[model samples]
Target: MSETESRPAPSQLRRLPWSEDGKSAYLSTGDGASFLARMADTMEEGMLTTAEVDMTRALSVADEVSASRAELKMAVRFLAHAVADAVEVARLRGERLGVDPEAKETAEFLRRTLTR
Candidate 1:
């Protein structure tokens, strides 16, 4: 057999359930959850960094029309979405694991924040 025929087809490779793109695999529920948590944390950190940059620029320069404010606003929106996604994932996971009271409380808190 030729060298190409000896290898398995790409489609024959096993893929994780969470791997939508097929290029990467999460392997398990915990692994997917960990990835989501990390993404949320990174988004939050980015928001903080953007806010710090805006504040630093405001303090260092007298210009009131700096673009940093706009960047900070965008960062805040992204962080909000990230937080919402994380909370939703947690709520679903809690439901799957028998409805933890803390998860219900968290969902209520998120709802309150959204309404405000």
Candidate 2:
């Protein structure tokens, strides 16, 4: 819905964070060197890094037998959000690499295995 810096091409929409209005935002890095492109790249990287940290901490809290109910709830909530963000990030990256986003989602595979 919003352009980062310049007009994007016909295809190759880069998935960006949701807009303030709660709509999907996209960018076309015409040449992959636009100011917005760089910003988006940085933001995605930060998201992934932060998610990893949050997931790690959350998992630790979840595994603690002595953890309070409130502490466990907080951990599970953080983990759920981190996993959602990660799924989107992975899907976008997979598309950019010419891979089918649904080819074999790690999350889906995990769910299937866990269910069995």
Candidate 3:
């Protein structure tokens, strides 16, 4: 379950996949070790990988001086999607970096929650 970015407490929110309605989704994690957190990490990695491929293909097409208008249009579309994916990856990494990995409170909280 993800709370929208419009909510408060940015440091605690990990960006998740978009909702069915297309709104951005976020997860509140305890020590960032839960199944959901791992899933989010995997998703973020996938997004970046796919974005890299998309950007590479788009650049290749754009570099071709003789690219047809239709080809250029497709490249633009791909580039736009790649940029959007990168933005989301940045947001997720930013939020994660803001968290202090050495924070005892988070570790203790996760330990308690997991054992219950």
Candidate 4:
């Protein structure tokens, strides 16, 4: 007997579940999602590291010279804003790809930096 004749038709495959809100959420009952989540976490970590490095460099520069207090504060504020922007972009990218980004790590880094 031919393979097609021996097996069930394409329509026999079960339909995937859909969310009530109509968001096309993927059922990650598979290994792919776990891998992707790790990838997203790694990516976000890298971006966060880069942002921290940039901020640290600016902070160092501010500490070096006799910059006015206002100028130093402005520079630090700008660096913080840039870090926030990077975090949002990273998180959005991960979410769109059905992955969970390293939100806690990034937030902790930002918090510690700001506190110091």
Q: In lDDT terms, which candidate is top?
A: 3
Model 1: how large is the Cα RMSD against the reference? 11.1
- For residues 8-72, write the lDDT of model 2, one tens digit per residue: 55356776755657887787656667888778778778888989998999999989999999999
Clashing pairs in 3: none
Which one wins by lDDT: 1 or 3? 3
Structural similarity to truth (TM-score) of each candidate: 0.32, 0.70, 0.65, 0.37
Tens-place lDDT per residue, model 1, 15-58, is: 33233665544322333456655564465456556555655554
Clashing pairs in 2: none
Give the Cα error of residue 71 in candidate 1, in Å: 0.2
- lDDT of each model, Cα atoms only? 0.53, 0.78, 0.80, 0.60
CA shift at 5, candidate 2, in angstroms?
A: 19
- For residue 84, model 2's alpha carbon misses the true position, in angstroms, by 0.9
List model 3 lDDT by residue over 24-110, tens digit each: 777766454899878877888899899999999999999999999999999999989999999878866856777566665787699
The candidate maximizing TM-score is 2
Q: What's the C-alpha lDDT at position 52 in model 2?
A: 93
In terms of lDDT, the poorest run of 10 residues in model 3 is 1-10
Worst 10 residues of 4 by lDDT: 10-19
Q: What is the Å distance of residue 77 in model 3 from its true position? A: 1.1
RMSD, model 3, all Cα superposed?
A: 13.0
Native-vs-model 4 lDDT? 0.60
lDDT of 4 by residue, 1-116 (tens): 99878655533322222234775323232334466456555655676677777787678768878887877877788698667858665545544454334766787799999999
